[model samples]
Target chain A: MAVPATRHDHPPSRRAAESARRAAGRSLRLGFLLACAIFFGLPVTWLLLAATKTQTSIFSDHPLSVGSFGNIAQGWSNLLTFNDGELVGWIWNSLYYAGSSVVIAVFLSVPAGYALAKYDFAGRKALLVLTLIGMIIPTAALVLPLYLQMNALGLLGTPASVILPLAFYPFAVYLCYVYCTTSLPDSLLEAARVDGASEATLFFRIVLPLSKPVIGMIFFFSFVHAWTNFFLPFVMLSDDRTFNLQVGLMMLLQSTDAINAEGGFSALPIHQPEAALAALVAVAPVLVAFVFAQRYLTASDVSGAEKG
Target chain B: MTDTETAGRRPARADRQGRRPASGAESTVEPPSKRRRRLAPYFFVAPYALFLVGFGIAPALYGLYTSLFTDSLGAGTEFAPLGNWGEVLTDYRLVDSARNVATYVALWLPSMLMLIFAIALVLHARPGRFAAAMRFVYYIPGAITGSAAALLWLFMVSPQVSPFSPLLDLLGVENATEAVSANTPLILALMGIAIHAGGWILIVYAALAALPRDVLEAAVIDGASSWQVAMRVKLPMVSRYAALILIATFAAGTQVFVEPTVLATGVPGQISSTWSINQLAYYYATQQGDFGKAAALSLALLLVGLVVALLVIYRTKFYRIDRGLS
Candidate 1:
């Protein structure tokens, strides 16, 4: 792949050619990035526009064209009317579920990962191996088993059914483990211990303060996991009242003819606009979290997990 | 809680004492603080272990046990070790779903990996506000997940009101139903790329950012072209991240559920209800009321994912825990 140095011998023309090549690459990179940006951003933009349009105009007008604010208001009103503001309940349920699970996941994962990285305990390697397996296991694999387990325990349809499983976040555990290993200095902890600080005090004062970046990462990721997860909640909770936004959106769109006009009953006015609005509602929180968590996202490097 | 905490710490001192000889300096009369220090890890790890065992290991083991039995109307549940597995394996729908998933993984995985690396490397090549802005733009779609992705992409693929209507028209798709029925996997692959690739781009870019600047500068000082540097140095350095992406996306692609499920829910009778393998397992569990078949099929899928994961782990030395505090 290396170009020979023969091209470097010719002075003016070679320099010009090099500059030309560099310019070409620069534009090429920009073009590729712009195309990717469009590919990634178009649907979301279209979705935003779809929410502002009336149901008829959604299918009739230009896909990216903006409709009146009146139409967005109309769509909002229509969405609110779905099953007597069940959308609101779903949003609240998502916040409660994701929020509670994130708190538990952070608490559990940080301490466990800290121990796994810092301690020479008897079952340390085995725990790490199990955590790796648990991290990579497909969601589909566990949902039915979890459903069966929850049903047996009579925890089905409870928020705990979703929250508890979501809190068992091995990926966040691994992240914290890597962060603690790579970023957290052993010397600092050692110094604190030498000062007669209890392990608990050292962890709470020294480790917690130093580990905010990783803690933020764990919080954001676990929140996103609990928020976006569908199958587990779908299986665990059959009652619509308890469904998170993901499951609720599915139920809402399925019963009403939102996307496909021919399939669903037209009993509700929850068409393309309303569905789009619900989608916006569902994505808005995660988007906000993403923006807020952007600073911490790159700082807490999971790539450090691979380095010996 | 404090009582149990102290109770858990007692065994560490005893275990340490038993391990040491009677004449050893630390054998007799260990300090309480030292004993507590020895037990701190266990105390730190205990709560998550309970969760891991309760949710992670217990359900999987129970699923394996569940897969061994067959439920019948009058005969009750009978222990036929391979009955559900055999029945699920022989189902014609399994073959189709497997083929669908294989095709999807083939289409999505390699292309997404390339795009992710390409975008990440290019962004890393010229890190600035524009690069940061592009990464954010790429990531915006990722926040839309599951059913939201379903809604977004369902409307996206439909020729009638889709922003890509011109492209669909060129592809000769007349309507939403025709568009979906004709090109479910392709549409899903595109949707998969859009919904997924951005997050990976961000991740890969972060890994790239975390790369040591001195080495990259050395390569540049040695007159390595950007392409050469990226391919040889940066790519190899970030190959672990690539492996991480591959394992995650493979597992996700195999267990493709929400897209097909919600898509089918929208366009009934067009896409089969049991379109993906995971969906078939769900159908078995829900529609057929057979947990055995569901558990069998899902475990079978999990086994495929685990095999790939183990291979990647071995190849990349992913879990080589050498530099930790211990």
Candidate 2:
């Protein structure tokens, strides 16, 4: 009777200790995540708040304290007041460039990726090798060369110079290639081919329909790339009228004493609040896209892409 | 629609090809279909090929050619082989910038990878609304990039105005310039991680989610702890994703440009204008107006990136065409 009682008591105590350990681990994980959240969340929160404060208040007040919505409107008006509302033009140019480039990038990437994945052809390996090189070659390395080529072609300072190089998006192609190889099965393609479907018909009817997820992924990334691309456009376009928000914002902050109090003596009302507001405006579209496309960003059968 | 139409269509196609159809049903349609199939890949690849050659390869080759010649305002372009290359290679500024980039990458890559994997694995451990919310919170900063990111981070490092005031004060940073000048690499690494880590975390988590449920269940049933399952079972399985992340981040980190450039602009004189290797290349082009030196430096950077890329590609069998898939 004593032995049986002791055994029963031992199991309960062990189980209680195990539950306590698990609970401690749970809280620790939660604590770490929340700390990360604060680290990631503070700067943007401060930016939004900063847009609502005056230049002096931006430095004086608590970092996350709210000032007023009217200050944001004031900041917006001040930003517009610069060079007769040039900020609006910059926004439009960003949309035009990114929109057109993304369309071209998606259309080119999907078919090329599908062909590479599904078909066996001569020079397939060579094409793969070149695409990998293009994918990894940093834009800084390519931007100057691309500039020289554009200068020789007399395409400098044109939208085409920025749009054309951007549309040659190797990363999007690689993403599609990986997606098609992993998620897209061969048996389905073979069945479609066995039917009276011609190659064009097969691509348009079957491959296109099945490629929607990758196409979405490609579109989002390429759009983000083109819209946020400062170096390429800065090198290519010298005209202030053609400047995207990224370059324009840099110019805005630099010309005004928004960040530093040393040298900027411009009469324009562009200050720290205005700069923060402009940053928010620049980020807003990408954030919207991220919210919508978050689901598509997930890798499907990504293990297949990794052979380990 | 019918088998007869399909069969007859093949014969017509073969005849149009100026070749006779074969004797039986099996062989009759093979010749034309085979040829059509052979032609299909090229057709699919043609447009991309045009862009690749026109934008990617041609510019690169032209850059190589440009690097061999020297240009001057008064004198016409001269074929001075390796003249610009020699100048750029011997420049002390190049060495300084190279060291800066190397330090930044060294600080950023390992920390970012560890955070990405840790957060991703933890999220995968108990995936629910909280995990989703964490991911959403993490990804918000990534949207603010390039110049916008520069603007945001400028304020972030300023002790007086930043939300991270206490942290900055503890680090003994007095002002924005001091924060940036004294700890540029550390600050940039933190900023890079904050901006880039979220996207990678989402990717790794997705990979984890797609893992076979049965294998994990088996491990659990065999009396494995969660820690054991994560380290022993899941980590090795997701090593490929880690490799992919490594190759990409390595290249991006080596070409660090916009952060330092915009930070320098904001602070005026604290950070050097040519603080990064890529910025030095740009300096050669824009400030000096010497395209030859610029081309030489950029090509050299590209070579460095390519060497790492080739090593990763070979190690991972990245370009290997699987026989079964083919």
Candidate of highest TM-score: 2
lDDT of 2: 0.78
Residue-by-residue lDDT tens digits, candidate 1, B1-326: 33224323432244244433421346477888778888999999999999999989888888888889999999999999989999999999988999988988888888988899999999999988898788878977778876556667777777877898889999999987898998888887887887788877866776666554545665665567999989987887666567667877888899888678767755668888888999999889889989888889988988888889889879987665433221
Number of the top-ranking candidate, with lDDT as the measure = 1
Q: How much does candidate 2 score in TM-score?
A: 0.85
Q: Which ten contiguous residues of candidate 1 chain B have the minimum total lDDT?
A: B3-12
Q: RMSD per prediction, one decimal?
A: 8.8, 8.7
lDDT string, candidate 2, B1-326, tens digits: 43233323422133223322221235445577777988999999899988988888887777778889999778889999879999999999988999999999999999999999999988888887788789878887887876556667878888877899999999888999888888989888888888889878866776566564545655665556778889987786566566667877888888887678767766668888889988998899889988788888888887787788778878977665432221
Candidate 1 error regions (>4 Å): A1-16, A114-121, A151-156, A177-214, A298-308, B1-41, B212-225, B324-326
The stretch of ten residues in a row with the least summed lDDT in candidate 2 chain B is: B15-24
The window of 10 residues in a row where model 1 chain A has the poorest summed lDDT is A299-308
Model 2 DockQ reads 0.35
Please, what is the whole-model Cα lDDT of each candidate in the order they appear? 0.79, 0.78
